[model samples]
Target chain A: MTQQISTMTATETVIQAENVNIYYGSNLAVRNVFLDIPPRQITAFIGPSGCGKSTILRCFNRLNDLIEGFRLQGRITYHNHNLYAKDIDPVSVRRHIGMVFQKPNPFPKTIYDNVAYGPRVNNYEGNLDELVESSLRRAALWDEVKDKLGENGFSLSGGQQQRLSIARTIAVDPEVLLMDEPCSALDPIATLKIEELMKDLKEKYTIIIVTHNMQQAARVSDMTAFFNAEATAEQGGKVGYLVEFDETTKIFTQPSQEATQDYVSGRFG
Target chain B: MIPAAQPQKSVDLGDLKIDHSSRRSLFTIAMTILASACMLLTLIPLIAVLTYVFLQGFRRFNLPLLTQLPPPPGLTEGGIANAILGTLIVVGIAAIISVPFGVLAAVFLAEFGKGNPLARWVRFATNVLSGVPSIVAGVFAYGLLVKTGLTGYSAIAGGVALSVLMLPTIIRTTDEALQIVPKEVRMASVGLGASNYQTILKIVLPAAVPSIITGVTLAIARAAGETAPLIFTALNSSFWPGGVLEPISSLSVLVYNFATVPYEPQKQLAWAGALILVLMVLMTSIAARLATRQKTY
Candidate 1:
């Protein structure tokens, strides 16, 4: 019924994946992923366990390149620059596109140093103290840590450490932020705080979060992508494929695919 | 009295409870006693040795015990300070030679060398090296350094021997410590765009530092106590160890040399040297154990 609404407006598509397939050694891990991630939007990848949702999320910044046998047959472009092109340095790509892991994997440094690490390594010439303060403030962690910035990063509680990791990622002034279930290791209250922080973050950065919790995707993401696996004899096991991609509200309400319909209704993942 | 027939009152099967006691039995008590007895049995020799050394050594303790050289035969007035200084200098040199190679080898095995044939071979060599007699290490160093004309029966030669003995221990322990550093920590660093070198140097190595220090300290202690390696390499000198290139008298070697002599004063000095050596090793090992208690996270 909508006449002239393009799925992704011209200015919106910051990252576009064209026919993506990932492999680990000989196993086709994920297949046939065609998606466009809008800039300054919180996009969530929601799926069941071991569906390679995390695997696909890692590919956005070529984080998957670190894996021993990881291979991708896909054209993933960041603002139309081929990320996998031989000339494109993966380290610089990762520098511009930061990531927060599922665990609160802070470096064994003081809280201040943890946040300052990225900026330092990338040779950020700006005032470090101000940057650390502002980043921590943005992550809702400054007030709690201001007096004890020299303490080890692990001295903080689980949620605080997760926030510290986010601060660390943002301190580098990245164009895109990748969060792999950043709240899974946190308590419910902490998860709520992270979700709220995600909402505020979209004002300045594009964020792609991979989440196992369906409600989290519904609550925070502007758009949602669902992935599912199907057994294939040729592949010799189940390999993940993107099942649905749409506005979060629509995907949760009136999804076009039967699998999406079943998933949102909690019938099956 | 008539158990089977009487319990037909349904036995209240749901009300019946199985024993969940965690209490120890007679067998457990007996085993604990046996283990303690076995431990005490082994400790008997240790206590006897320590007590004997202390009894003989304490009577000769004076300011000169740390300030003067050993006395001539029949004279019981001086101390083995030359040997003490010699031991420190030789062990220090060994640590200097061993630590860098051990730490680097460990880093390679833990980071880049996992499952690689060359690393596996090196690790295997280290294991074999750990098992080799310290005297053999001394003989090898004697042939390589002393006979080969690099340095003859010198402290540096002794250090090389001790380094050979210490390298395997340091490498194995450091490798184990590095392996325990969570992969996520490394991934976190690399994910932040740090290169492999940066991630390992700034993150992985620092995280593994405490445990590595413990291993390095223990390796030093072990090298400090080694007597056989020094015999073929360092030999013995009554004078203060001049430098790494000169013949050195380590406490272990001095004890070996004195204990075999027929003189009474020399025997007493040997007892004192033995005491100092044991205490030095004991202190270093305790410090290492404490360092190991620091959390890797």
Candidate 2:
């Protein structure tokens, strides 16, 4: 399928992927992806499992660099800076674009330390106590965790831990927040709370999420990109491609592609 | 003709029958007895050794024994204080020598060089080194350090010998400890913009500290009781240990020397020294247990 451009103005786009091909060694994992994520809005990547949504999401912050054989072709740009260029350090790139993983993985340290870790590593020259407090407040976790900030992060409940992870990610003051299925491991009530938090966060940070839940994409995202995988003869066995990209309401109500329609209406994936 | 098979809709709890004397029960009882017998068999040697040592050593295991120096062959009122201090100094030096090198090598194996050719050869070398006898380590250290006149029959040479024996255990245990840390925890660190080195130093190493401490303690325990290495390296000193450059008297070496003498008093003191060495090793093992029991992550 051809690339589908959304109605959003290009001037507002904070991240752009142009003709990107992701590979693990010689095997192509995702082929020819083009996406433009606008600032201060939620962009959700919706797909079935093994469709490379998470893989592409990791590319934004160059988190894929940790995998031994991962490689990316073409370009991913954050505000016209070529992220894969020779001089660009992945560590610094990560400082500007942070990530929240599917499973909430807070450090084994105290809650305060967990939130302060990123800033400390980045050498943030500010009042650390205030930063931790604001980050926790912005994550909607301050009230629940404030009294026990000295406790180990592992002591918290699953939902609160996930919130703590969010607080930790934001504490570094990243311009973009990449969440890979942030609420998948959470209960419905916790998921709803996170959805509300995402709605609140979109006002400040450029939020890009990869989700398996269609309703979550519908409820929380401003733009939605639908991806689908096809069987391939390559060693990787399957290759994912973007099937459709548009406003969330349009994609949910009347998608241009049959696959998107089938996926959204519960006919197929 | 086959009767119509009727599927029971629900279980009747009141009518359920359980056989109390089935073959399974008999097998379970037989296995339980065998396991208990095996456990008791294992405990016998430990209890017997402790009981015998306590009985023989209690005669000389008095305050004077810990405070006074080793007396002449016929005298009976002397202490093994010099031996105790020598053992502590030698073992402490061995720990200092082995711990840093072992941990760094383990870090290389577990993190930076995993699955690489160099790491494979390192692991192979560590395994072979661990299998090498403690006597061989003593000889190697004697040839390298003591015979070279770098440190002649001194505590430093003994430390080098014991450290050679200690290194492989520390490296292997620390590697295993680092390997068992959750992958997600590492990913979380990396995702938070930490460089690989920073992640290892700040997050990974701290999380593995408890297990690493356990390994070091066990290594120290093994080194403290080593008599063969000290025989070749730190040869016995009649007086108190002068310095690291001079010969020293450890509890194990004292035990080996006095146990074979013709005098009965020296022989009694030897039993007391053996008991002290055993107690030290036992305490170290208990410390290792407590270290591992702590919640590290």
Candidate 3:
């Protein structure tokens, strides 16, 4: 399943997670994780279900804060700024770090309004029409939707709606794009389209994706982090942790950990 | 060590049997007839009321009925136009007062204060308030406004009383509508850097507008038919309504005041007023249906 893609050698880190642990109420969810994300490259988190890949991805932009009793320990720094600092606003954090969800959730609005909503909320004083057009172009949806800007967003197919969501996210001009299983709901052809889109998006913004599809991780990501879950003493409770993080090609071809080998070889039960 | 061999069982693939029982068919026919009888029984009262109102009211349902005030005891020469106008004024004022407060309270309950202790208390209060008797609302208004001599027995007091009746329905429906919006839609807005207020105002509220309209219209229809509250608050007048601050008449109160009189002409006017009130409620229901059919998402 390994597909060769151009890889960039590590430069200075754009985001760093140090000794991170996440919890919900009294129970631990993900424990002891350290990882660095570099700028202008695609980093993929791949693991089985309940491995906290999505949870860790959400932490990068503080999206997990929406859940009740969600707590994060240790430091997450973005470009040397402590993301968890008492004064840092999660609202502003999300403005700089945009997200795409697992399902294609477009606002019940016109396609043009859907893309323009971010800029309007941020009080953008430019020609909004230009910004929406360029964002749609970057997300590879402009040509398909150029003629019908006033159509409701839900009128489009699932893949087009997802692309419109991506357009809506990028319309805010974020520095980082965090995608949570963006293609899990799409068919094979739609999934391939989004994979190609990710490869194109990485040249401008740092991309972090969490996916259960290992072949997708192998095909498009420059770096890959593998996470695995272990059972707790409490019956049926599992806590996720980082198993290995390396260059995607290296991780897929010659991983250092036995668990990584089992997972990549599809031997995991 | 191998055990003895086992014999293979032959597979049976017989045709499926279908039931065609005459007794079951007869029982089904009997049940259908019984259900139809119950349904017809339920419609009897409604049809009788409508037919009786139409037969009696049409005798007096002319142009003058919509343009003139009610005549003296046995004259039978005027209409209940003042009562119609007063009903509109009172119900309009009630909608204006209740809609904003109810929707804002619903937003608080559904979005900001979802699991808070205050929200639970507010929800409980709303349910109790809805169950309070209509006559009690009228008496409360009498004590609060008429007895206090702030507005006396005026249209303003009547409007306030009707608004009290409308608030619970508006709050309950709008809260349920706001909650029916998918959680992911809110997340999408938040993920795009929109503030909580911005998300609610632009995204969540718009999605709930159709249901909100349906709720507000139903509340208005209910408020229009209420007579007990207006009896103490509005205090029916013979003359046309001069202003909202003055005593006013409504179709419900006019019907109540005139229906039991010994004069034949006044009783006919009461039947005509009842017919108009029924038409108003029917029109409001149709408007609500049309509103709910609008494409929100």
lDDT of 2 at B14: 37
What is the per-residue lDDT of model 1 for residues B29-90, given as tens digits with 9 covering 90 to 100? 78889999999999999999889888988877778888999988788788899999999999
Which RMSD does model 1 reach against the true structure? 3.4
Per-residue lDDT of candidate 3, residues A1-269 (tens digit): 12122244556788889888999997899988888899998999998899899999999998888888999999999998999999999889999999999999999999999999999999999999999999999999999999999999999999999999999999999999999999999999999999999999998999999998999999999899999999999999999988888899989999878888999999993
Error of 1 at B244 (Å): 1.5
Q: Evaluate model 2 with DockQ and give the value.
A: 0.74
The root-mean-square deviation over C-alpha atoms between each candidate and the true structure, in angstroms, is 3.4, 3.0, 5.1
- Model 2 chain B: worst 10 consecutive residues (lDDT sum): B1-10
lDDT of 2 by residue, B170-211 (tens): 999999999888887888788888989989998899889889
The residue-level lDDT of candidate 1 at A222 comes to 92
Q: What digit string (tens of lDDT, one per residue) describes model 2 on residues A189-262?
A: 99999999999998899999999899999999999999999999755599998988898999999999888999
**Candidate maximizing lDDT:** 3
For model 3, residues B1-297, the per-residue Cα lDDT tens digits are 222343563443332333446677778889999999999999999999999998988888889999999998878789999999999999998899999999999999999886699999999999999999998889998999999999999999999999999999999999999998988899889988888999999999999999999999999999999999999899999889999999999999999999989999999999999999999999999999999997464
Model 1 stretches with alpha carbons more than 4 Å out: A1-10, A234-236, B1-26
Q: What interface-residue Cα RMSD does candidate 2 give after superposition?
A: 1.1
Estimate the overall C-alpha local distance difference test score of candidate 1: 0.89
The lDDT of each candidate is 0.89, 0.91, 0.92
